[model samples]
Structures are given as C-alpha cells and as structure tokens.
Target: MRKNPERRASLLDAAIEVLAREGMRGLTFRAVDTEAGVPGGTASNYFANRDALLTQIGHRFYERLEPNAALIAQAQEGPRDRAKVVALMHELVERVSSFRSGYLALIELRLEATRRPELRRLLTERIRADVDANIDFHLASGLPGDRTTVVQLVLSLNWLILERLTLPDVFPEEQVHDLVTDLVERALP
Candidate 1:
C-alpha cells in the first residue's frame, strides 16, 4: 500500500461517490480509481482489500461529517433554549440534505456491516462513541433531556431524517420540518 494522504483521501471520496451512486456492489478498486481519475492500480495501492476500503469509507464518512466549527460556535454562543435547539435541528436537516450522497454511502455501510462481524463491531463502537459525544454535548449545553432520552431522540430523528432525505419523495419538505419541530418540542424540556 502506498502512503499518499491526498491521493488516499481523494480515492476515499470517490469511493463514497461510487457507493452512493451504485451501492456496495459497484464499489470496486477500479471503479474508485476511475472515479478519482487516477491510475488503474492507485486505489488497490492505497487499500489492501475490499474490507479495508469499506472500513476507510466508513471512517471517511464521519471524518467528512465533523460538525462545522462555525455552526458549533454559534450554537454555543447563543442561548441554549428550545428555539436554539430547533434551529440546530433544522441545521442538521439542512446538512443531511446537502450531503445526501455521503449519507447514502453511510447507510450502505451500515447494511454491509450487518453481514460482516468485524465491520459490525467497528461500526457499533463508532456509533456508541458518537452517541456518547452527543449526550455530553447536550448536557454541557444545558439541553433539556436526560442521557437516554437524548440518545433515543438523536438516533431516531437523525436516521429518519437521513432516510427521508436520501430517498426523495418520501416526505414533503414542510412536513419534515414540522415533524422535526414536533419531535424536538417533545424531546426537550
């Protein structure tokens, strides 16, 4: 395997696109190399095997999904009220809409994990860490929810919204907003 960070990142991004556009079956090293506009063997050089490539794609999805610093700062600086929470939820929805492809790839990763024990373990750990971090953030921000409530709310709402967003015509835009608002109101104090 080669050690080119930039190339590796580009190939992973290409992998995401391939996964999104064609699902798991289409995510081959040659496909990634073609998508990345690199040499035929470039992706194989960076990724030892399909499992390694898929794992990296899962990692890249989260890495690309780190919350925007400016948005986080804005949320932190402002009052931590229901309004702020609703706005944050809307922001999250907008983010999901914008990165529909990445989210689709993430969904594919989750399904693929179900049949692979190692990937399943890795994804489970990653998800738990994410939930823990979200819980901590909510507590630190003085959000009105217990850890369990927050965890359930975040996981449920996020997946619902993501599924709807990636698969168009599932829910109307206004309905999505209204549903999210209703959920937030109930989730928060």
Candidate 2:
C-alpha cells in the first residue's frame, strides 16, 4: 500500500468525481485513475477494493463539505435571534450547495448504502452524529426554536440542495435564496 497522503487524497477526490458523474456502478479503480489523470492501478494501490473506495469516498465527502470556521464564528458573533438562525441556515445552504460534486457523490453513496449494510451503518452513524452536533450548536448559540427546528432545517435544506443540484428546473434559481429564508422563518420561532 502506498503511504503518500497527497496521492491518496487525490485518488479519493477523483473517486468522488467518478461517483458524481457515473453513479455507484461507474466507480472503478480505472475510472478513478482516468479521472485523476494518474496511471492505471493508482487508485487500486490507494484503495483495497470497491467497498474500501466507497467508504473512503464517504469520509472524503464530509471532509470536502466541512463548514468554514471563520464563517461559523462570524455567524455566532451576531445576535442569537431568529434572524441569526436564518442567517446561519442561509450560510449552511450556500456552503453545501457550493460543493456540487461532493453533495452529488454523497447522494450516490446514500443510495449505494441501501444495499450494503456496512455502508448503511456507517452513513447512519455519521449522519446522526452530524444531526446531533447541529442541534447542539443551535441550542448553545441561543438560536431561536429547538431541536425540532434544527432537524426540520436539516431535512428541508438537504432536499433543497438536491433539487438545486439534480433538478434546477424544479425551482427557479432566484427562488432558492428566498426559499431558504422562508424555511428558516417558518421553522424558527
């Protein structure tokens, strides 16, 4: 196994692109290598098998989508009111939506997880932890509403992101910002 962290990261990122473009069935080592412009078998060296590749891609998806600390801090510094919650939600939508490939790949992983129990368990655990963290962050920030508010926002916002990425025609581009605002306004106290 190769110990080049940079190369491994690149292979994983390439795998993400393959997943986003070709879906789960297209995620092969050769496909990843071609996507990454690395020599054939490069991805195989980095990942043991299809499942290993999928699992690593799952982790990479979150790594690529992690929120910006500075943005979080700035949002937190503001008054912790309904408006603040709305702002945070807006930021969250913008951040997640910006990583189009990462989000799309995540959707693929989720679907694939249905048939693979290990993958399903991994996703379930990670998603639950993320939800819990969001709830905790919202409460500690003195944001309006409660756990339900956070959960509702998470659910609605994810669907919004899916619609935005997979079916832009479903909602006009300009309406997205307003929709996020409306979701927050309606979800929060």
Candidate 3:
C-alpha cells in the first residue's frame, strides 16, 4: 500500500534535520518520531528498516536541487550572452552557499554511500542527469563544446566553495563571487 505522503514527507524532513544535527547515527527511530511529532512506529511503518529510511533521506537531498535545474535549463535555452550565463551561475552558487544543510546531507550521503550501492547509484544518476542538463543548456546557449569536463569542473568548484565555508576565517563571499564569475567565463562561456 502507498504510504501517507504527509507522514512520509514529515519523516524525510525530520530525517534531514536529525542528520545535520547528529549525522547518520543520530537518525534513531525515537529521534525521528519526536522530530516528526508522529507515533513511534510511523517511520518504521513506512521504511520497514534503517536502509529504507536512509535511502529516503538521499532522495530528499536530490529533490531540493530540482527547482534550480529548471532555472538553469531556462538560462541555457534563453540566452547566448555571457552575462546571462554568468548571472545564472552566480544565483546557483549563492543558493548553494545559503542551503548549507542540503550540502551537509550530501557529504553524509557520500560517507554512507560506500556501504549502500543503491544510494551510490542513485546519486551517480542524479549527478549525471544534472551534468547532462547543464551541458544541454550550455549547448542551446551557443557553447559549441564542453561536454565532459563541465560536470567535473562545476562539482569541483562546488566542493571548493563548501570547503571555504568550513574555514576558520571569514567566508570571503566576494572572493568566491569573483572566482565563480571567472569560472563562468572560463567554463560556461
């Protein structure tokens, strides 16, 4: 039978919150129950096991990126101008900076995915699709090439930005903005 969407969604939301606060070990059923304000068995009823619950968390992690995908695709199709492409990348970079929890969840997923092939495959596919989408967008925008390397470059830049945020020093947002802007001209242009 289909699980109640509200309950399922609530549990997923709670899982992310718990994951950020406590890492994967923090996702005890009791913690999720309290976080969701649901009955003790509510999450278990849907997931039936810990792996199921964790997989759902990974799915939620990817879902948060979906809206931005369309915006990027639109930017790709709408303009060949370098300024527009760079602007879209700026918005994307800014969004990533603001949405720290999702990034943390992704870091956790990477650590956990080694033992969970399903998650590894799911994340792999999601990344491939994102890269494909971005490439298509760039192609439509009149980028004659840059098929394989853009994904690697974009993700590398993302990791660099995240790492910078973890530094003891001030975030240096302007530096990152300038850096990403330069990357846009070099990579997406």
All models: lDDT?
0.84, 0.89, 0.73
What RMSD does model 1 have? 1.4
Best of the candidates, lDDT: 2
Measured with C-alpha atoms, the lDDT of residue 55 in candidate 2 is 88
Q: Can you give the lDDT of residue 113 in candidate 2?
A: 94
Cα displacement (Å) at residue 109, model 1? 1.1
Q: Give the lDDT of residue 146 in candidate 2.
A: 90
Could you give the candidate ranking by TM-score, starting with the highest? Answer: 2, 1, 3
- Per-residue accuracy of model 3 over 126-158 as CA lDDT, tens digit each: 777877877776665675446654674577677
TM-score of 3: 0.83
The global Cα lDDT (0 to 1) of model 2 is: 0.89
Q: Give one digit per residue, the lDDT tens place, for model 2 in 1-189.
A: 898989999999888888899988898999999999999989888888888888888888887777778977887796888888877788888888888998999999999999999899888988898999999988888878999989999999999999999999999799998999999988863
Number of the top-ranking candidate, with TM-score as the measure: 2
Candidate 2: where is the Cα deviation over 4 Å?
none
For each candidate in turn, the TM-score is 0.93, 0.96, 0.83
RMSD of each: 1.4, 1.0, 2.7
